[model samples]
Target: MRHTPPRAVEVHKALLAHFGPVDWRPSLPPVDELVSTILSQSTTDGNRDRAFERLKARFGSWEVVRDGEVAAIEEAIRVAGLARQKAPRIKAALQFITDRRGALTLDFLRRMPVEEARAWLMQMKGVGIKTASIILLFSLGMPAFPVDTHVHRTARRLGLIPPNTNAEKAHYLLEAALPPETYLDAHLNLIRLGREICRARKPDCPRCPLRAMCVYAREQGSGGARE
Candidate 1:
């Protein structure tokens, strides 16, 4: 292994070659992005989209979702799973933002520095580092990397970071390696590669551009099992 890890530019180029410019993000309003990110937790995107549609049908606006009855909100989002628990959390977060800032818009946080905005978002209910980073990168167009399970698995398998790196650590390590301009695209691109190519049980190494950089792929060549 090399002393200092290679730059993310090379890694990113390899990733892009394997997964040709994935642009699959939901094109919603920033607040819609926030709500959808919450709804997406512990559920599939399709199911979350269904729940979001139902919620929109029932409420008609973010203000309604923020101020509506918890029971009704939960019912609207039941398809997303754990709606009973997630609904109130979503509504409460929306309410808090609206109350504290007079608007639930992400503009306030977007104006602040990345760290400050991330901290403020984490202070809200149900907003963890992953969620906060998603809000920043996806919604606010800020430079923050949101690492999910797929990213963590792929990064470890490729020897991009240490195997035991938690989501937060992995996020910063990746961010530091790449330019801020690459943060948002890299997040989505890696996710696509993880899902389509570098899968958990059966990574399509032969078809992956990052195979050359992947420790697991090299191990396969040497007849060694993946960790």
Candidate 2:
């Protein structure tokens, strides 16, 4: 008999059974969340937090960061890794928004349609589908799904998306496959699952909640067919 790949919703349900409830709500405003997400690229959470705090402490405001010397801004975020690259991108993004909207706040995105807002954010220097979705879903309370490295890998292992699908395309596919209400929980749990069980290097497939339904786990002989 041929095995059918699990649906995204089915995988989501399995994840919930394993990981339980997760809080994915964003406590920060859109702009703050944008900056934080930018800082998160290519860095650990601890380093990202320290870099964010340092930048905020040094600049005092987004406008100052945007207008300040690039070298100074880079110095403030040196601990985040890729500070030279990230600092310019962050400053340019803030400047882009300020130039277009005349302010640093992204409250306007909350009013725009999801796709429109996503497109608008994508126009920024370093923003992409993942970053735009993060701003939309977390900060603006939209239904967009942001696919990071973990979510991308987990989705592929579960066969929720094509094996070769890039994270950028996977974002839309996964978002479309799942109900809007399930996005937050599914996204959060998938990240946790990826971190704890379905890791990139050596996933603990035997103990994975979705192992029975996971194509990768099945191929590895770590999990059997679903009962």
Candidate 3:
């Protein structure tokens, strides 16, 4: 990542070719995104969405969520797994935003520098780099790249970062590899690859479009399906 990673450009192009254009638009308000992302931890997408929907239905507003009974909140998001832990974190995040910004909105982050915005959100309980970056890139259209489990795995396998790199460090390494403009598409595409072809338990290396340039694929002797 000393310079624009020469491999990253090819990886981006190949992923786009295989996955088609990644047309991502913000799907939630920043606050909703923050809460949903917090709920997404250690859970599947279906579970995360279900939990968010239930939480929203149970508490009609962020203010209500902040002040509502934690037991009630925990019950609503129980399907998400670790409901006990997530419920309090969710309440604390809303409370922090209310306390610091004097309201429930995270819209103010949209106007600040990306780093400043990231820093501000990370101040909230349970809001780490991944959660903050998701709120930034997905909701606020900022340039911060979030390194989730899928992304982290795919990045290392592709030799984009050091093999032993941790998720936090991999975030910056990937940011340094691809341009800001490619973050959304690249991030989504990498996650797709990880889920479909480069899966955690038994990656389908032979069927992967990235097999030609992927370090793991080459090592496994699986040529690119497309290449």
On TM-score, the leading prediction is 3
What C-alpha lDDT values do all the predictions have? 0.82, 0.87, 0.91
Error of 2 at 211 (Å): 1.0
- Could you tally the backbone clashes for each prediction? 0, 0, 0
TM-score of each: 0.91, 0.93, 0.95
lDDT tens digits, residue span 1-227, model 3: 34787799889999999999987789899999999999999999999999999998988988999999999999999999999999999999999999898999999998899989999999987999999999999999999999999999999989999999999888888998999999999999999998888888778888888887889888767743332
Off by over 4 Å in 2: 1-6, 223-227
Winner on TM-score between 1 and 2 is: 2
Question: Residue 208 lDDT in model 1?
Answer: 76
Q: Write the per-residue lDDT of candidate 2 for residues 1-227, one digit (tens) a residue.
A: 52333587788888888778785556878888888898999999999999999999999999999999999999999999998889899999999999999999889887888889999999997899999998888888899999999999888988889999998899978877888888889899999998998888778878887877788988889742232
RMSD of 3: 2.9
Q: Worst 10-residue stretch by lDDT in candidate 3? A: 218-227
lDDT of 2: 0.87
